[model samples]
Target: MQHLLQIFILYLFILKIFGDNVDENFPQYPETKQLYETYDFIIVGGGSAGCALANRLSEIENWNVLLIEAGGEENKRLMDIPGLALQNQHTYFDWCYMSEPFEEAGLSLINQSICVPRGKVLGGTSVLNHMVYHRGAPADYDRWENVFGNPGWSFDNVETYFKKLEDVAIDSPSLPDYFGKNGPLHVECAEYRSKLYPAYMAAAHEAGIKSELLLGPNQIGVECAWKTTKNGYRFSSNRAYLVPIRRRNLHLKLNSQVTKILFKGNVAIGVEFVCANQTYTIYSKKEVILSAGAINSPQLLMLSGIGPKQHLAELKIPLLKDLPVGQNLMDHVAILGLQFEINESPNVVEDKDMQLKEFLYNQTGPLSSYPAETIVFSHLSNGIPQYEDDFVTSTYEQQNHELYHFSSETWAEAFLPNNQSKGAFYIYPVLFKPKSRGSILLRDNNPFSHPRIFLNYLTHPDDISYLVMGIREILRISEQPSLQAFGTTLYKNKLRACKQYEFNSDDYWICQIRHLSTSLFHQSGTCKMGPKDNLDAVVDAELRVHGIEGLRVIDASIMPEILAGHINGPVIMIAEKGADIIKQFWANRKVG
Candidate 1:
């Protein structure tokens, strides 16, 4: 009984210092005597970008900024623990969306669609995502400038903002120039050392893949994941940026479900929202910024009568501006659930109580490490297709398998599985820069309803061909000498949908991909940013909604194309840049 009591005391001490007690560090939101009638900025969706924008916009002293979130603060046990990353999905903190039935891909999934988990909490999806910190290849940003026709969005211009947001905790003395020294967001390579880490790196090297450091000029390589964790807990956008700066200038409204942006003529004037069964309208004096992320941002635009002409007309919505609000949806889809058996038992961080204790006491254990600890980025496309521009430009039907059957070199991101039990691990292969485009449409005109998300994944033949080649590459990696040294064996999950095909055959693997592939949740590009000439462009280079005044979207939805890696880092960078743009505009206006 004495031993048990001592253990309990130690556990409480650890949690107080590192776990539950960390909540006390945040400054409380100032009490408001009354709700202000207007504000300089009304930022919707207190998510990744919303939090950052709210913090930055409120820095202008008297500039009253209102940040409204549908979900509550990220104060749950599942959110703090790195091992329980996926446990947040489908919970109250998640919007728990489902994509519309895929016409070609995801043939075997439940309801023939994938679960689109958007963060409903204060931190947005930043609190929900696997904390792999990535900024994508330099060429990715160059494409944003050269290919997508957004001039200032080049890698050079955006690189500075990424550095501004990151406070790198990586100890690699040689990698200093590539990372920020004292930024607010804490980023470090996962600390928990595992046998699988070296083995995976060795396997990659043996497979002719070179190890490369990220955030530098070259980003493609197998390395310990750069994560947004510090002291074994998630350093979310809300925690890193909002909580510390909860000043009187910034007003945070929780559970405020925005139904529509209130627009008068062509300008966004205010927002109508519901909270606790009561409805209220909050007006924006200067601008209404939509940082509702990829899913909700476009959904709000459509609901506010800013979308395709015919689609809005069908819903009897009074069209404010006929823009492509929900087209050009792109996400990094992955073929996960690939398990491999090993000679030694995998690291057992799955134990909730033990992992919690370790995180509290030492801040260096399985709980301190990101689940997808190692990642490899490789190109599998044969060559650039002849109708590459046509593929990216064509309508969803015109850009189908008939136009492009993917050849030559394209990008694939490989991740080592997070599970640490049953003497096994899995390899998750994500199809980066997919040619396929999806759409988000209104289920009805109802503002409180969820949007019909149609992530037409693998609709393009190139998407499937690249994934097929990626699976072949994964198989080759599993057979490498380093993995073989650990008695590595592929754990083949027999799919009932693929029972017609023989196991391990190319056709069977293809069947498994269509049946079992899932989304990496890096959803983007619904509100694409392009020049005025571009018809599908919803927002301009400044993130302002086309043909609409005082409205701008500063979230993943404005990404012209998805990045080669995770979207969290890039999204934060976008918010930083967007805030600067808004500030610069306001400053110029004052001077004029």
Candidate 2:
């Protein structure tokens, strides 16, 4: 009877937190009523890049900036809880995009298509994503400059922008030179460490992988993940970049979906959008920046008749400019079925009442951290020293891998059936750089319809081989003495699709890879940025759309190649640099 009562009370608490009336003391951002017919700058998609861009540009005082978002204000009561990060998916806060069916991957999923969750809220994906703060690798930016012909995007040139946006509060061996003491974004190590955390680190050490800070000089090894949080709460891009500067000259319009970019001949003039059953067209005096992420940004450009001539003509939309608007789609693919059973339960309070009380009072409990505790980066090839300076310098075609350590019950409940037993954890081996390329296309002429996304995962044989090798590397780590002492063993359930092959054979792993392939939510490279001579390039080094004036793309879509790690940090950095570039262009124009 006591147990039943406790469970009932806990359920009530859960309802209160997730309810619509939960009190979060933040200022209510009602839609700004003060209207402006024309602004100096208009930024579409108040996402990670858009928020930062609006904050920086509005500092000029004279430049009135407008930021339009397709979603409502962020639900702080639900989003502030870190452990509930994955719970945000499929909710109203998420775009909940469904990928087009592909036979090669996601065979086990419904209709052989995966669900891609992009945030539709004010902060964009930053509000919906697991708050892992990673800066990718320095070599990634070097390639953007040398190989892609983007002049000022080298590691040395962009590192300052990274420092300018960070406020590192973690205690680690990471040097001060690599981090900023005061910046808007607050980054810290996850405060709540499960018992499995130490065991996982020990297992990595026993397997010859050293423990090192990923944000430090080295890129390969195991470490506790740094998150974008503030005082045990999720610090989304909206909170970091927009909240503090709400009083500035920036006007934010929520729930406004942009349908097309309005152009006057070769120059972008404004945008046409719909809000509350009303269609409106607003103008921009200086520039219109598109930061609607990898998927929607390309869709908007193509809808505005700036895509391939044949594709635009098929839909009967007249062409204004001939360019490859939605090519080179890439994302980090991962095998989702890798699981292991361990003897020890996760280091979390089993009592739901105590868990809630601890979180409400002190903010030091399992609810304070994301389910993913640690991340590992490594090369699958042999004969390469792990600690060499060239660890991150390998070409994108090589076999580079990243593994995620997820809590036991969280992994099972999310991916497996309800009948599956608990006390199991997951080690998902992610292919950081995939050679397989995909594309985004318009389903119809209707701007309200969701765009068709095709992430052609594992189409390249090299990509499949890399994932196979990554699985082997993870199995070796499971055999280490540290994990063995905990009585860790692989979950022996055979996927129904792969039951024909021997369980542990290479062929079986490959089958599993195809059936349960998932994305790490790092989709990019759809609108390629490069030199003008490159036929595939859509934007120039300055992020200006080719042959178009007063228009630019300033988001992950402009990445010529996707970076090796999470993209949120890099997107913010890009916006910081982009803000400077825009300021410089106007300042020089005034002088001339």
Candidate 3:
């Protein structure tokens, strides 16, 4: 009886901290009672991009916009807490897609396949992501325009859209012109800073890398990462875009899965989806925008008979357009098992009940922040002679290498001790611009079934070598006097898989890199955007399918090349620009 009372009290405490107002008054699921047979625009997903698109497109008022999402409403109690970010993964809110077993990489994981967690809730992956808001380097967008022949996607052209969606709450003196004062998405640094944060920053400085804003003029240093949060809670796209516009002409349908796109000859007209155990067909008067993300967007296109001719024919589905619907898949891959032990204990939490009370009253405690403390972007080719291979030198010259520092207490709670005495953290070296590419293929004709994801990580020798060099750099940082002051030492537990090679040898690290490789969940470029002359181009520069009219893919799937940072910020910017492009296209037609 006492245990039950304790549980009840804990629930009340959580409710007190997060409050029951938003969840209690959240717009009803399937906001519209009667389904409209036709709408001016039909969005296929209510994800990060979809929510922004719904808000922007519905602003016209006359245009009735319908957003169909496969998942239900978000669980505010669990999702709003910044500290419970990873706890949301592999739950009912996640799609839980797994990559195919690799011969080289992910050998140590279950089934030798890595688990890819894409949010299945209303806010999509934004609800499950680490909330770090980072726009890629200016050169990244420049390459998108100059190298890929995208006319309006240069940094200069798209900079306004970046500002259009951001509302900066943190004080950044050097980034005065880069931030937007009034926007829906609130951007701020985490309130709770652990003792290890300063040590990590000092250690980076000791290694000759100074602290600078990651989104400022240059991204070649270290700094505290900014996040998409407001008042110690997550500010998801659903919260930022959909909730505020519930009274508008926007119609949202929850638990609706779009199975196929209806087309007339070469023009997209409507979509067939299932909701509440009944299938319905909805028509789009203007265009059918695909914001179903990299995985689902490609899967939906292929299931609707618009993919590779040979693959479609094999499935007995008639080919509509012979486009590369699911190729050139890119993601940021990071090496695991790189942990450092420190003598200094973690931030002391005296009493769990007191910590809860502090969070409930002041909203400043361990619960107010995610564990990712600082990020470092560096060029590895200049100093390391042994790793200065041709590919590494050229790629480093492009400035795409990124290293992340994370407090491992929250991440490795299952293995670590429960007390706050032991202190340890992780420094992950991420491969941002991978030369190796994978593909996505339909498992069968069923839209409900997950697509066969082939994330060919570390297939390229250059990628593995680059990661190895990054590990060496991390080792150097650990050896610095600033970190050594904390008695920082690399955890030297030898893995069974690499026992044959000498410990700390190059071969042992290479073997460990393959066995423990994992993804950062930034999958993109499945539906490559390029010029019409490019045969492998799935969508044109204007985001329209190459051969099909009145259809556009405006999500990460259309990225010609994945950027050098997290994709959430860029995805929102894409939707913002795409909405403007769409409004212009229709307005011009009316004028004509």
Poorest lDDT segment (10 consecutive residues) of candidate 3: 389-398
The RMSD (Cα, Å) of candidate 3 is 6.4
**Model number with the top TM-score:** 2
Per residue, candidate 2 scores C-alpha lDDT tens digits across 1-592 of: 3323433454467667645443454664556887588888999998999999988999899999999999988766566778666566666767879899998998777677877889898989999887888787888888899999999998899999989999998655547478876888999987787767777888888988888778765678888778998777798898888887665578899999999999999999999989998998889999999999999999999999999899999999889999999999989887776667766566567454576667666666877787678777787222111111111100111111111222333233224332333455677788877889999999988999998999999999988988887888788888998878767787765466788899889999998889878777888988899988999999998999999999999999999987767889999999999999999999999999
What lDDT is reached at residue 418 by model 2? 26
Candidate 1 structure quality by residue, lDDT tens digits, 1-592: 2333433464466566666444333443443446788988999988889988998998899899899989887763446667556555666788989888866776655557778889998999988888888887777888889998998899899988988998987666676577777877888877786667778888888988788775566655566677888777788998878777658888888888998899888889999999889998999989999999888999899998999999999999989899999999998887754667776765646465776666655666776765576777777222111110000000111111111111111101112233434466667678887888999999999987889998888788888777777777777888999889878887655456667888778898778778666778899999999988899899999999998999999999999988877889899999999999999999999999
TM-score of 3: 0.90
TM-scores for every predicted model: 0.88, 0.91, 0.90
What's the lDDT for residue 504 in model 1?
79
Report the candidate with higher lDDT, 1 versus 2: 2
State in Å the error of residue 185, model 1: 1.0
Instruction: Candidate 1: list runs displaced more than 4 Å.
Output: 1-33, 171-175, 348-353, 380-422
Question: What local lDDT does model 1 show for residue 276?
Answer: 86
The count of backbone overlaps in candidate 2 is: 0
Clashing pairs in 1: 381-408, 381-409, 381-410, 382-407, 382-408, 382-409, 383-408, 383-409
- After superposition, the stretches of candidate 3 with alpha carbons farther than 4 Å from their true spots are 1-30, 348-354, 380-421
The order by descending TM-score is 2, 3, 1
**Top of the candidates by lDDT:** 2
